[model samples]
Structure formats: C-alpha cells, structure tokens
Target: MDGYQVYRDAMTKDQWQGWWVTWPLSTRVRLGHVYDRKSDGVRRAGDLAARGIPFQREHGTPDGTFIYDSNESVDVAFKASGKTPAALSALTEADAGASVTFTRGRTAFVVFREYSQSGISDVRGLSHALVSAWWNKEWDDSLLAVTSVVAAAGATVLTAAEGGAVAELKVSASAGVGELGMADLALGASVVRHSALGAQWTGTDVTPFYQVIRLRKNWLGKIVAEYGPRPPGRGALPSALPPLLSEEIGDDPEAALEPGDRTEELPFHDPENE
Candidate 1:
C-alpha cells in the first residue's frame, strides 16, 4: 500500500491514542505512539526499557500527549506488542509530517511549517537534497541534509515537521560522527558565505573566525582519519577540547570569534590575506 494509506489506517486505529511514522535513517522507518496520559506512556516505555527494547521518548505535545517511538521491524514489533499492555506496531507509513508520497522508486515528503517565501525555498531545496540522498543511499549526504536543516532553522532541536530524522541524527551525534559532521558543514558554509561577502562585510573582519573554523575543521579531519569514523567502543565520544570550548564558541560565529585572537596569528593564514 501507499504511504498515505498506511498513515490513514494508523491515525484511525483504535488501539493507540495517536500514531505516526518517521524515517530515523533513509534505510529504516520508526513507528511512534502517543498516549493520553504521561504516567501510562512512561510506564509502558519503562516496561519496554526493562525488556531491552529500543525506543525513544519525545517531548510532550502541546496537548499533553506523551510520545514513545521505536524502530523495531514489523515482526519484532508485533511479537513484542504482547509483552507490554500497549499495542505495538511497525512503522508502516512514511512520515506524516512530511506527507510524503512513496512511489516505486522515488519518495517525496512535505514539511508543514510556517515560513517566509525564502525560508520555504530553503527547506524545499534541502528536502530535495534529502530525497536525493535517500534514493542514492548517500548516508553522508543524508546527514548533511539534517545539519543543513538545523543551520537553516538556527536551532539545535528540530521542528515537528523535521522530526522524522531526529532519532537517527541523535544516534549519530551520540556516536560522535553526527556532531563532528555538523560542525564541519556549519564551518564550511560560514566560510563560503564570508568569502562571498568579501570586502562588503561590515562589523569585525571575521578573518579570525575563519581561522578558528579552519583549525577546528582540520583537527576534526585528523581525528576522523586517526580513529576512523568513530572510536572503537561505545559511551561518550572523545573531544579534543573541554565542554567550555563550545560555550566559548557559542552559537553565533561572529560573536564567538573576536578580533586579535591568538589563533589569528597562527601559521595557517586566511587565503584572502595571502
């Protein structure tokens, strides 16, 4: 059946308070459930956790709906459904938020968020990129799509319309690859924009900012090359700098990189300066 049909059936199902579907990764889909009460949802999720089932709890909706989602295969979900009092289901639908149409080969999903014309255009472009990445099995490009959306939205957390990819990105970030990749993409995009502005740039030259980004990017590259993707084992990913470094950098590149920073004088000078 088509994605819309699956979505309609899930939404109309009587067993769960609410239901939705998402693509945690291009290759896998997750089924999500909403409950009428937090306690019921928490208890059910806790039971799953105790049984070593993989699931993720999302923030409550505006109406106090508690959410829990899992990426288990259809057979597994059905088998596990009896373990808990709640009925479990496989992710049979494409992301409802995206309203995606899944045909034989191509998939197109919509994002339902209010945005200006420019914002809409940006999201549409990134959505196309995401679709292309999915079709081509380009995991890095898929990751890039997620980061680009975050950059475009200027937020760490994604909107409901963009929630489909959150779980997978979180898993990747936990593994260290996601965060490093995001940093690289953001820095690269900033450098490109800065270069495009050229002398027309106002405020601080931000040449220092470019240097910092490059140093960090190069360091990240080295780390990847050394460790190969992620470290050997699981747990918190290693960081070259302390958490305070992120605080110092803050979110704004302009504010983070002031003039006359020590790194500005480092051997790697800006190409424009050379």
Candidate 2:
C-alpha cells in the first residue's frame, strides 16, 4: 500500500496555518559542554523553562549500564483542526502550561503549549556560536525547514501536499573551521515517526522550532496528563503608546484596544439593566 497524505487527503485550504512545534527537550551534552553536571542540569533546565519548551524529565537507565537524566527528547507534532479560528486564537491565548483543543473531521486534536528554543542564543559558547554563525549566513533572508535525509526537500515543499518533509537547516562555510577552530564540527539528532490521534506525525529532536506543544494523547488512545502550575490568564492587553510626535507634554494616553485584545465581560452591567 502507498503512503497516504494526511493534510491533503483530509484537510482544506484554510487549515494551512495550523502548524505547531513541540517543546524542546533539554539536549544531552558531551563532557565538553558540562562544566558541572548538577549546575549544568539546573542551567539547561532553566534554558528550556525560559524558552517554554515542554519536555519530559527522565532519570533511568535504558540498558541498566548508564543512567540517563535530563530532557532526552521533545514530543513534536503538527496540530490539524477544522476549528481554524479557535485554534489560531488559542495559540495566542494559551500559556505554556495550558492545552488548547481543535476539531478536524469530527475528531478533536489538542496541543499543549510550551516555550521553544528555536532561534539564535545570545550566550557566548561553542554550540551557540556554531548555531548563530550557521544561521546568520546560511538561513538569513530565507524561509528554512530542516529535517533528516529521509524527509529533506527543496524550497517548494509544502506540509499539506507532501505531509512528510523535514524543516531544512542548511549550513556551509568556506573554511570549515571558524574562530573556535573546530574544523569539522557537525550536529546530528533523531527524527521519529508517530501515528496516532487520527494523525500521522514525523518530528526531529530540535530543528529551529518556534512554538512548543504537547499532544493530549499517545498512540494507544490514552490522555497524557501533564504536570505543572496552571499559567495565569493572558492578562489585560497593553494599550499602544502615542506616536513619536504625540509624546509631547499634553498628549493623552490613548485608551483604544488593539486588534488582538481578548474581549472580556464588563465588570458592571448597564445601570438601566440594574
């Protein structure tokens, strides 16, 4: 049997914008990156936390020889839904600790929100320098999607039509070595295939993903209960400041709500109704 296209076979045009990335799993570092194992653990955890990458913390041995601790992998998947407006709105409204649900073809797919470590990092380090220098020149001024060789494609690749492609991350330098002088440094990670919750998903560990999400269930039709403090509601939206010229002494602070403000119930009903 041939492979079936998930989106193209199942969804419509307006559903194109419903893509989401999963939380980043704190990467396993070699001895070079670990100054102090415990301290490094804290820092790495903080890094994932700060970026809101949802990750599973593990503390066990896969083979009973080596005990693995820290974020081993990220649960990355695409969210499909017919509730396009509701899903899109939830992306802006949901917090890292919350999960948003969307419907597609009478089935509901929910994605839990979290932070993602997807862009350049300011910290000065070997890995950061490698990623920054690579992205600065290679990915600048271009749309990029990087996946493993099995799912690589050119500029025309579409998730809906293809339903099976990796986001690309192309990097090349004239001199293989940069200031760090590691002449042949390369990065490698795993990408996995998942078929569940009425969707077929393929994901790599970390490939410059922006949004962090968690699926509400595993392949066995079980709800994966996530643990964390419920994040506070996206608070009162901020009012825009006056323009440069209007910043003069007498300029009134404009009280108009921007287009993205969440409409809330008025605290007080009309006096006439009362």
Candidate 3:
C-alpha cells in the first residue's frame, strides 16, 4: 500500500515518528472533555472513553470533543453547577480544577486527554506495604493512583488535571505497620506551560454541570494512611467495646449478675393490700 510505503520512508528519516507517538502510556491517562447525551453542543468521543458513545456518520472521537466551526472559530462552554454564594466566592478566589461530564442518551462520557480531570490516572510504583496494608484487595493496582487533586485558575474556573501549574507528589512508604509514608514532593510545584481557559477559550450554548472539590497532598496522604492497617498485635481494651443492653442479659438472673450484686424479694401481697 502507498500509505505503508510512505510510513516505511518516514521511518527511514531520523526525525520521523510513528504510531508509538500517539500510543497511550497508561489507560488512566487524561484524555479530554466528555459530552453527555443531553448536552446540546458538544459531541461524544466514542469507545475512546470506554463509556462507548456511538459515532455519528463523519463524526468521531476528535470531532466530539472539539468542533472547528469557521463561524465561531470553535464552540466551548464552561458551566458552574454551584449555586451557593460560597461557590461563587471560591470561583472568584481561585481558578478551580473540575471534572465535567455531560449525558448522552442516559450515558455520560468525556474526552480522554492528558488535561481531562475526569479521567483516571494510575499511581505507579506503589509501595509494597502501602499496597498490602492500605489498598483494597479487590481494587486493581493499576487503577489505584489517579488525579487526587487539581487546582486551576481562570475567570469561569476551568478545572484541569494536566498542562497547568501542578504540585507533583513524590511519595514513598516506610516498612512496618502504622509507619507514616513520606511525601518529599514539592508543594505548589509548577507544571509545564500549556493552554488554559482564558483568551483562547470561549463559551458554548450547552450548560455543563460540575462539582467543586478541594484536595491537597496532606489530605491525600492522610486518606492513604487511614486506609492502612493498624500495627500488628495491637489489641483494643474491653472498655473500648460497646456496652451491652439489659435486654441482652441471660434469662438466669444469678448468671446475669456481675461480681457485685444484691437481690431482694418483695411481698407477694400487691393486689391483696389494695
């Protein structure tokens, strides 16, 4: 095939890149925004999101996330689902990182891109102790590490996971139970320069519903640590156990009595006296 020949020729060139260039390193890698069935303007990025939005004729994954309208240049909308005054205040205070999902035919989907906050990201090289002690046995290790927190800056508060100023964590777990994992990663670390919501971005007709979640490294570490097992041989005291109710007592009153007890028999003349 001519295309194959062209590929062979391109490979001959030192600068030529191939399929691996576009290959995804991880399944959880951020892709892009997803348009739901109900969403008016945005298109769905089929099968790519794993949610499987069917592709319309001539419309595919890239087309769904990005539409190059000559008239509008491109259509994009930022919707803030928060109705509270504080929500507005937080938006005003700092650019928020958000995960936006629109529904399509009762199924929700988003674009898979490096910047998509909604997408999952794997935390690789997890500590053995962290895995055995903290991680749930049922959960897949590859799916464990994701974008735990994201903070964005902009007028409408476009939340982004990648391609913005980010604090990258370099975490490691210590051996033994109950030992705290160390986070030597820098706080407020800077991310590579990339497109952000602002001059280059505009709005669309579709109203996007999203939530504002705040997470920090310390908070994430706390969560990871909390899930960890307690140190070995550490037993709870009897006092720590919940107290039993009187109804739970045995039928035999003598058996039910504790170390100290006094029993008295009243006269049987209750009705006779009356």
lDDT of 1 by residue, 145-170 (tens): 11101111110112121222211111
What overall lDDT, based on C-alpha atoms, would model 1 receive against the true structure?
A: 0.20
Question: Against the hidden reference, what TM-scores do the models get?
Answer: 0.15, 0.16, 0.15
lDDT of each: 0.20, 0.20, 0.21
For model 1 the local lDDT of residue 26 reads: 15
Per-residue CA lDDT of model 3 for 79-159, tens digit only, reads: 122322233222221222222221111111111111212322221211221222222332122121211211111101112
- List candidate 2 segments past 4 Å from native: 1-108, 121-197, 200-274
Residue 5 CA displacement from its true place in model 1, Å = 35
Clashing pairs in 2: 23-54, 51-115, 52-115, 53-115, 145-167, 145-168, 146-167, 146-168, 146-169
- For candidate 3, the 10 contiguous residues with the lowest summed lDDT are 258-267
**Candidate with maximal TM-score:** 2
Q: Candidate 3, 222: how far from true, in Å?
A: 28
Model 1: residue 39 alpha-carbon error in angstroms: 48
lDDT comparing candidate 3 with the true structure:
0.21
What lDDT tens digits, residue by residue, belong to model 2 across residues 34-73?
1111211212212322322222332221211111101221
RMSD of each: 25.8, 25.3, 29.0
